[model samples]
Target: MASEESLEESKKKVYRKEQALKRTAESLEDDEEIELPRKRYYRQRAHSNPFSDHELIYPAKPEDMKWSMLYGGSNEAPTVADVGCGFGGLLVSLSPALPKERILGIEIRVQVTQYVLDRIHALRKQNQGKEVDYTNIACLRGNAMKFLPNFFGKGQLKKVFFCFPDPHFKLRKHKARIISPTLLSEYAYCLRPGGIVYTITDVKDLHDWMRSHLEAHPLFERLSSEEEESDECVKIMTTATEEGKKVARNGGSKYIACFRRTENPK
Candidate 1:
């Protein structure tokens, strides 16, 4: 059993480590911009919040989280988080599928983030007293890589999605790639035992890279092809994601992998 003093020290360590990540990530912001290919994209909705007198189902701290209350009933609702959630596609879609408090959408882009916020607000206004309640989806404009630990405690998040993350194709720019050993550690840290990390990309090379890293990760167990196929929850790479749809329309084949977080090594 961990002593009180040991637990306090652990919390302090977690805070310090998070700060270190922020400092190191600062370097990524200095890269020069280039005229990138203008991929076909959709426009974002305007900004507005529609919730009126909404109460927080759980306290700000993850330690204060109550799973039973968060899910309203005996059904185990997945506290799903869409990391690198761009334009709120997956977040908004999954919101109606589950309880409002259980779905969180996190994105870094300020403009798109505000757009999603407005879109949800519009949704809420449109669905007043309806079965499709939009309050289940909330968008936060912040870096997912750093804010992940701040919002969630160890073993709290159930499903984490990294749908079509920036590949950062160059070898020299691999660190900028979203999937890495360090990032995977943070993903594993947030996930409860048996929680899964799902990733999809149209880039074949990036797909292989993600598979290699996740498979080699100590905290993750690679799901067998048969297991992945059998699990309805872990469905195949789909056009559900905005980027996935774009890639699919372009005749690109999506590659996907799912890894379950096993128990901490003794």
Candidate 2:
């Protein structure tokens, strides 16, 4: 029963965090320009170590999630997920671009997640009653590597973005990289056949590593150059991520590799 008690305590902590988040969003005034969250105030280490949970909240399963608290009006489950969504650049960019689809940004850092939450609330209030009010986009605090399948049902997501992910340079730490053989299976299971997986990174070694793994996965097929160029999501991702912007400012190279989730083998 100790294990069960621990689970209950974790759930309570998560519930309290949710309530605090609600209060923060509710406290925002419907002003001409809702005050934007300051990055300096939401200070967090550049690289997050996912093993550190810090007592955050997540659903036991997808069904138990309270998505309405994360979004304003949308009742639909998120169709797109941006993993390691630092500062939520892609999440904000994709909001108006795909107003019909619910986009969820999953980040592990508590302060970063709070900043994204505040930023989203500000954006919604700023664009209130506009054509695209950003009700379809939201951010959540969770470890995507460990809990993605718990939050996304089978064949639930149509698009998944891994933009400028941590390279995990040390050979011993390669297993910590997000696109490992085992994680790819979970990704494939969550995405429907023909769904797209978009990955980009400035680090060449990490690029090659992710590409090789996805290629080896039986359920994934690499997209063609023409297809990558033509995809709107790919285009947005190239410039929408915070790390992508930093790379551009420093004149670094970015490698992109996209794959299609194919049907499960008979």
The candidate scoring highest on lDDT is 2
lDDT of model 2, residue 206: 94
Worst 10 residues of 2 by lDDT: 25-34
Model 1 residue runs over 4 Å out of place are 1-78, 230-237
Q: What local lDDT does model 1 show for residue 228?
A: 79
Backbone clashes in model 2, listed as residue pairs: none
Candidate 1 versus the native: TM-score?
0.69
List clashing residue pairs in candidate 1: 100-136
**Residues forming the 10-long window of minimal summed lDDT in candidate 1:** 32-41
Best by TM-score: 2
Per-candidate Cα lDDT values, in order, are: 0.67, 0.87
Q: Compared with the true structure, what per-residue lDDT tens digits does model 2 show for residues 1-266? A: 99997877686557546545655666673344556766755666888886665576778888887777777554568999999999999999998788879999998888789889888877877787899888888888888888898899999999999998888899988989999999999999999999999999999999999999999999999999999999999999999988999999999999999999999889
